[model samples]
Target: MNYETFAPHPNLDAIVKCHWILEVPGDMEAPKQRVIPDGCIEMCFILGDDVKRFNSENEFIIQPRAMVFGQITKPYFVKPTGYVNTFAVRFYPYGFANFITQPIHELADKETPLTSLFEESSIKELEQKIIEAASTKSRIAIIESFLLSRLTDKSIIDNIVTSTIDSLSQTKGSASINSILKDDLSKRRNLERKFSKQVGISPKQLGRIIRLQAALKMMLNKPGENLTQVAYENEYYDQAHFTKDFKEFTGVNPKQYLDNDQMMLSSLIYSKD
Candidate 1:
């Protein structure tokens, strides 16, 4: 398995987080990998064989070849059908809304093909370019060109949403909406409405995901760190509180996360982030 991320173009640095690529050999026996919410949206192009997202023990669906997967609230499982080669754009929590008119909340917890969001002809052309690009660098150039063309003054994300996200991120998701808004109840209500539409999840949900991500980084990087220390460092109420939230999102506690073979993919991705 090989996974890597690249910086976005300077002009798109604010909204676009990074462009990533992943490749795994076809001959390897791949297991069902668990994917958890990371408080972000992704636009992906599957450049190799198909992938399956499981809905239940016996049910699964093939992910779109060129698609935008919305904000995920909980963990899900995916397995490669064969070789895995994918190129994707990781957008900030509020970033994807700046390029589409659809209500972002409507896209949560599932993958929507690009044709549904943009013109069919244009999407086809863009997907072709990405698939045929000679290298990852060329693919990044193609996607950036498409994104820059779609971006417009009217599509700019709301300032309140961006600033609030900044505050949450800076505090590692510990900051409350009231504190960020200086206890302005009216503004809190307004922000909640816009945040759901623009980010596909509530402010509090995103905060929790962000905080979980911080804890995950620590656990993966510092293998010797205990749960109690990890919880305190990330501002969880206590180890029990931390374990509850961890299980909610990951379907497993921190100790299991480190030892679970199924977490191989998620661990690789989170460690890099």
Candidate 2:
């Protein structure tokens, strides 16, 4: 397996986290990979083969060739049909709102085909251009051009939402919403409304996911660290609290996650970012 990420164009840096590519050798057996919540949305294009997203223990549907995967609150399983090759855009929690009309919260835990979001004709054309691109660099250029052209007039991000997200991110999701808004407690409900539309998840939920992400990073980067240490560093109340949240989002306990095949894709994406 080969996974890599590239910085987005300077102009897109604020909205886009990075562009990434994943490739698995055709001869190797690809394992079912678990994708966990990370408080972001993704726009992906499959260039090699179709992938399956499991909806139940045995049931799953093929993911669209060009699709936008909205904010996911639960972990889901995906496996390659054959060799895996994909190019994807990782957008900030509020970044994708600038390109669409629908309330982002409505898109939670769903994968919408690109055609549904954009004009069918344009999406078909964009897919062709991306598939025909000569290299990864060319593919990134194609996507950047497409995003730039579709940029919406709707504000890219709400100022309140941005500030709340900034605080959560800065504290690795350990920030208290009450404390963050101590100056004006009355706006709590208002913040929730904004989060629903712009962030696709409530402020508290996003913070939990962000904090879990921080702990996941610690586990990935410091293999020798124990749960107690990881939890303390991330500000979790205790090892039990950390373990519960970890399993809530990842569907597995910390020990099982440490050296598991199921976490390979997610680990690569998170550890690097």
Candidate 3:
């Protein structure tokens, strides 16, 4: 497996999180990767064997070649159907709203094709262009060009959302929803409505995911860190409560998560972005 990450262009700081490329061979077997709840959305271009998202024991959905995965509200599972090769864009929670017109929330549980959100012919060309633009400038310019040309609604770029995001990042996703909204209840409510409509999940839920994300990275990076401390550090209720949330997000106990055969995809924000 080979993984690479790149920083976003300064101009796209609002909508773009970062760019990444991942490659894993087909012969190698990996554990089913758990898809946790994250505050953000993703757009990916598959360069190899397809991936499968299981809806049930027997039901699954295949990802399209060029797809934008909307904000996920609940946990899900993904396993590569064959060798996995992909390049993707990780967007902030509110980012996709600027580029996509169709309510992203409606795509909560599925991998909808780009054509559904954009013009069919344009999507084909855009996909090719993004893949072809490997350099940082080229990639950033492509994303910016898409928004500037296709998404002319200047009002979608919001200052309040950016301010809230700044504070949210500083706290490592542990900020209180009430505190975050205390000063502007109306603005918070409006954000909630817009978030649900555009991002597919509530702000509070995204915050929890963010906190879990922080804890997951800490636990992974600092192997010696104890669970009780991890829980307390992330502001969970208690050790048991913390374990429960971790298991819910990961589908495995914290102690067992790393050892699992599945390569679960928790929020990789801390590591990549």
Candidate 4:
């Protein structure tokens, strides 16, 4: 397996997180990989063979060749059908909304094909260019051009939303919404409404996801560190609190995460982040 991430163009720095590529050999046998939420959205182009996202023990759906995977609240599993070659754009928590008119919340927890979100002709052309690009640099250039063309207004993101996200990120999701708002607790309801439309999840949910990401990185980097220490460093209430949140998002405890074969892909990605 090979995975790499490239920084986005300076013009797209605010909205686009990075462009990533993943490749796995077709002949290599692999288990179903668990994909946990990381508080962001992605637009992906599958340029190799098909991939399956399992909905049940034996049931699955083939992911679209070109699609937008929205903010997922829980974990899911995907396995390659053959060779895996994909190019994807990872967006900030509130960034994807500026380019589309559809309510972002409506796309949560599922893969919506690009055809359903953009003009069919244009999406087809963009997907073709991404698939045919000769190198990762060329692909980045192609996607940056596509995203810039669609980004009509750079300031479409609500200030309140971005400020709250900035706080959550800086604190590694340890800060509460109330503390962030200070005396303006009355705005909580309004913030939730805006979050649903622009961020695809409530502020609280995004915070938890962000915190989990921090913990995961720590675990991957410091394999010798204990879970209790990891929890303390990340501001979890206790080992129990950390375990509960980890299980909620990853379907496994932190100890199990280190030993689980299924977490290889997730571990690799988070380690890089």
Worst 10 residues of 2 by lDDT: 150-159
Candidate 3 TM-score, C-alpha based = 0.88
Segments of candidate 3 deviating more than 4 angstroms: 130-144, 183-188, 264-270
List clash counts for every candidate, in order: 0, 0, 1, 0
Cα deviation at 42, candidate 1, in Å, is 0.3
Best lDDT goes to which candidate?
Answer: 4
Candidate 2 TM-score, C-alpha based: 0.97
Per-residue CA lDDT of model 2 for 82-121, tens digit only, reads 8899999999999998898899998899899999998999
Clashing pairs in 4: none
Could you estimate the TM-score for every candidate? 0.98, 0.97, 0.88, 0.99
lDDT of 1 by residue, 122-184 (tens): 999999999889999999999999999988864458989999999999999999888999988
Compute the lDDT for candidate 1. 0.93
Better of 1 and 4 by lDDT: 4
Candidate 4 structure quality by residue, lDDT tens digits, 1-273: 999999999989999899999999999888999999999999999999999999988999999999999999999999999999999999998989998998899999999999999999999999989888999999999989999888888777999999999999999999999999895979999999999989999999999999999999999998889889999999999999999999999999998889999999999999997
Candidates in order have lDDT scores of: 0.93, 0.92, 0.75, 0.94
Better of 1 and 3 by TM-score: 1
Clashing pairs in 3: 31-262
Model 4 residue 50 CA deviation (Å) reads 0.2
Candidate 3: tens digits of C-alpha lDDT, residues 1-273: 777777776767767777777788899877667776667788888877889888876688887989988877666888888888787888887778878676767877678798888899988888889778766467657766775576566577566666666667778777876687777677878887777765678767777778888888888788779899999998888989888877776677888876665643443434444
